[model samples]
Target: MSLLSKADEAKLKGQLQDAVISCTERCLYSSAKWAAELLNSFPETDDDGSETDVDSAMSDPPPPQTPTPSSKDPIEARLEARETQKYLLAKTFFDCREFDRCAAIFLPDSLPKTSFLVTPSPASKSKPHGKSKIKLGTPTKPALSAAVVKGLSQKALFLSLYAKYIAGERRMNEDSEMILGPQDGITTNKELPGISAILEEWFSGLANSGRKPQGWLEYLYGLVLAKGKNEKQALEYFIQSVNCCPYNWGAWQELSTLFSTIEELHQVTPQLPQNIMGFVFQIYASQELYQSANQVHNSLAQILDIFPGSAFLQTQRALLYYHSKAYEDAEQIFSELLVANPHRIDAMDCYSNVLYVLENRPKLAFLAQLAMTTDKFRPETCCVVGNYYSSKSEHEKAVIYFRRALTLDRTFLSAWTLMGHEFIEMKNTHAAIESYRRAVDVNRKDYRAWYGLGQAYEVLEMHSYAIFYYQRAAALRPYDPKMWHALGACFGKVGKVANGIRAYKRALVAGSFYDNNVGSSFGSGEVSGLGGGVLDPEVLFNIALLYERVNNMGECAAYMELVLAQEEGPDYDESVGDMAGGVGVTPTTSKARLWLAKWEYMRGMYQRSMELANELCQDGVEVEDAKALIRDIRARIESQKGDSSVA
Candidate 1:
């Protein structure tokens, strides 16, 4: 008959409770006003007419007038009592912040009824005439007046929406999302529930009502969308949240993460939590916004005062200092942390890295020894020792440390990867491959291990295996140029000329991209000439040969010239022997020049070929081959001129 009546029927039928609450909320501006109106609306009929009792309306307890056992009408009083009880129950649930229970209470019949709410069928009674009598108790249900319904409406809707937002946030983590940088690898996926659909329903309901959701609701939705990789939607929600409540720190945190510049973060809120400040620094560092990162790091002391004894915050602060070239500050903080807790192997490793960068060899050695004293069998401690020796060009000692690390913990992924690197340095391809295999077994997503495998297989001339390993590495780190180059080389070895050409092209693009993109202090670039993931000019020379094999003479000559030009560049020297991550390798410049000379002679550029050959000989790189090429070119030129000249 009425909207309130319909809502009651819907509740009994276990449907439209959310809709009912939403509609009720639209009618009431605030819960307190609704409560006062609800209590005042109850009227009593006197001798002349109906009158409201102000005292009864003002107080939550029923009127002072007592209805005796033989009172005139009790139905209204019973309804009033029932409504008051239900309203109190709803209020209790809201007070406890158990919004889900409130939603469930309002929509109790929506799902299976609990045993307590179900009427039990009475036990059958046997009679003398073989007849059984059966009985069933009527199930009791709570009833609420329109006043009580309207009073609880706002809270019900708020709780329902809040619960849905929380559910969606939790489910979003199940989707495709990555936590850290490329090195952290991909996250595992979980089976999602119906949270996304619930969130959508909540939004749809709010939109239909033509009302903006609460500030916290917007924040939660933003976090959910962000976890789901819907950055644009997440950004919109985060902005809306901040616009609604500038003091919402959670919204500011999410907004800070989605934004690119410090200005965007400041727009969210100038005052941030220590953890949020740390996040800001990391974002700036990642985008190579060093100036901004340093600015934020400078405020670390003040932020730390608010969040005392947070090791994570302190460690991030130290890393920021390191990136800003405040190495002394970084080193000091790291030293303090390590001294406070000597078993902090990570701190020891980091401090050692900072010392290495500063070229403070004595301090680095002392840190390494301190690490050893803390835990000789710790994987990270051993790694620190190994990396130190490796840096000093002491391959044998590095191998011993790496081996000791593995012996202590075979499943240590870093040790396995680095040990393979050591083996590669020692020219033991077989041992390197085995170590890499173990690393892969420990963590298949480790790109470094895959790259090591690619190097070992390439050395053994197992081109197919090399291709597989390099492909894995490339999949994990698509930005790594060396992986693509190695893949191209393998393809060329397997006689897949077209594929080789494509891979080489990708390698060039990726290499240029890497050169332009700066990295964080903790990036792979920190340790130069140590990892296989580095630029290699030899890739250009190899690509040139691949072009030659395919008979693309123009492309072959163009690539050869590119190689020579690149070698002449200052940055080319840094990439000289990085290919295959091996030791004792000569620069590829000489070989590339010699190949270019031969290519020129084949293309009938005798004079140009002669110049390159003579230059190579004078430079004393591949001297014998260059001399032979020069003699042959001279002979060919004489014959062409009909001089018939000979030595």
Candidate 2:
């Protein structure tokens, strides 16, 4: 057997580890299992620590000459020792969702310690105590202790801590309702007391060490810091996590949820490392920001240029279109992805969402059936089924599937939001509000939940509270005209004319942007003046009404003119003897015309006023108001004629 050089051995192990990580990231568990088997093929090194043992298995069976200590890599030896440990098995268990089994593998004295760390001696029968480290030949079981867990690789340490955390959560879930009652959200729970002890004792002195924390260790520490509400420290550790593991999407996703506002995101942007991880993190941040579609699209284009084949990136692009309410484009992209990989259920939930919005019943039903056939247990599958039911207006059945999704994953944000939508449909306002609140708790960036909350409050006639929620939704999704329109409506409901006017102006701007081209990307422009579009006749009319409220007659008259110019509705066909058979004029158009007539009469433009009033009456719409206005104009014209004759 020929002994491999230390550098060669380390490089080989790194290659194997990278393969496993890549497979796992793609959720290719079977491939990961095969890779793990290949890893296991490399024989475990004995406590004596020799490259000969591992090399012997891979190469010739003949004995090899021992290399001198000076030629050995310390990292190589550490890597060998870790192979002898059960972390690999623990990791496998972690992937299988066997949290308790995974935790057990890392439990105290669980795995056999290799000869390098432990040696049996008849004289050293006693256990080592504090104040002194174990000497070379101490006879102790292969047990880990409070003072002994140091210098672990980030993955190793994170695995141990995270396993315990998951196990603790699973244990709590058995009787979660009894253990933690209603006020506590499912996404949050009390600290696992033992976790604190493990951090303080098992990871003793780690915080005090001079070494910078590795990514996963920093992630673990950040969890503790975040739980403590020590946001400053948590932010620092999370920043370190991304810096150290630039490709760690999970860490970036976690970091993305830490902030609730754009102001907070900007405050921390300078502190983030500006590498690919930070670049991707900014993209994640934008999902919540709801910036202009063009701006978001451009940023995504830069990343997609680097990784054109990434399904995750493509799904995000699809999501951008969905958020912009460009359902057709989003649906096309999602359909293409599914056609390429029919069994892939990754984002089918979102695809179903597009179908639901389009009311493509057949497509939605087909997706739900296919998703169920692929893997009914997945939360995405459940969501697709839920969406199918939702599209059918089967609110009760839809809620059940959405509930199942949440049961599978408490942090399933889409399930929570969708469930709230169903509750709203069923007129269960309180339940809808609660579900939306939980969605917000899971991810503050969920503008859907905020918008839902506003809708729920509005249904309850809580205008002030609805305003607060709508404002939050508007702030996050500034480019969404629906949010601006909502804010305008709510502001007007509360008698805030000036505020309502400003909000309507913004609504006009956003609506114009959406109407011009749903594909265009741009930030929400400031709005002192009104924007024109078919998207905003209602908004224009609202603005004109608000102006009238404040008695700004000139602005009111101008906006009213714009409203009439925009409405362009087909007048009711009173000529058809049966009114119901006529092409109906929308009430909005009728009211706008009435307002113009009143304005014209006040300006002594009696001819124009009578023309409009007569048009309204002849259309068989708003006849009573039109007749009254016509009478007043007649009286005024007669008075003017009488005065003229006197003159």
Q: What stretches of model 1 exceed 4 Å from their correct place?
A: 1-344, 350-363, 375-377, 388-411, 423-438, 441-445, 513-536, 570-587, 643-647
Predicted candidate 1 versus true structure: per-residue lDDT over 1-647, tens digit per residue: 11234334223222222222322332212322322322222222242253546576543532223222112224423433545555456546645656446445543423323344555455322222232222232222223233433333333433444443433333333332321124222432121123344445556666544343445456656766776778789888877765643334345545655654435555544333333323434343333222324446555554454334445456767765654446777888887777665666754555665766566677778778888887887877987887788668688898888777765655567677777887888899887887788787656656678888988988888889889989988776565566777788789889999899888778766654432223322224221121233334566677778888878888877777766665434333455643233322235767777888998898899888888888887777799998998889888877877864443
Per-residue CA lDDT of candidate 2, range 331-355, in tens?
A: 9999988887689788788898888
Tell me which residue pairs clash in candidate 1: none
With candidate 2 superimposed using the best TM-score fit, by how many Å does residue 405's alpha carbon deviate from the native? 0.8
- After aligning candidate 2 to the native by TM-score, how far in Å is the CA of 467 from where it should be? 1.2
Best by TM-score: 2
Task: Please report the candidate that would top lDDT against the real structure.
Answer: 2
lDDT of 2: 0.70
Q: What is the lDDT of residue 612 in candidate 1?
A: 87
lDDT of 2 at 612: 91
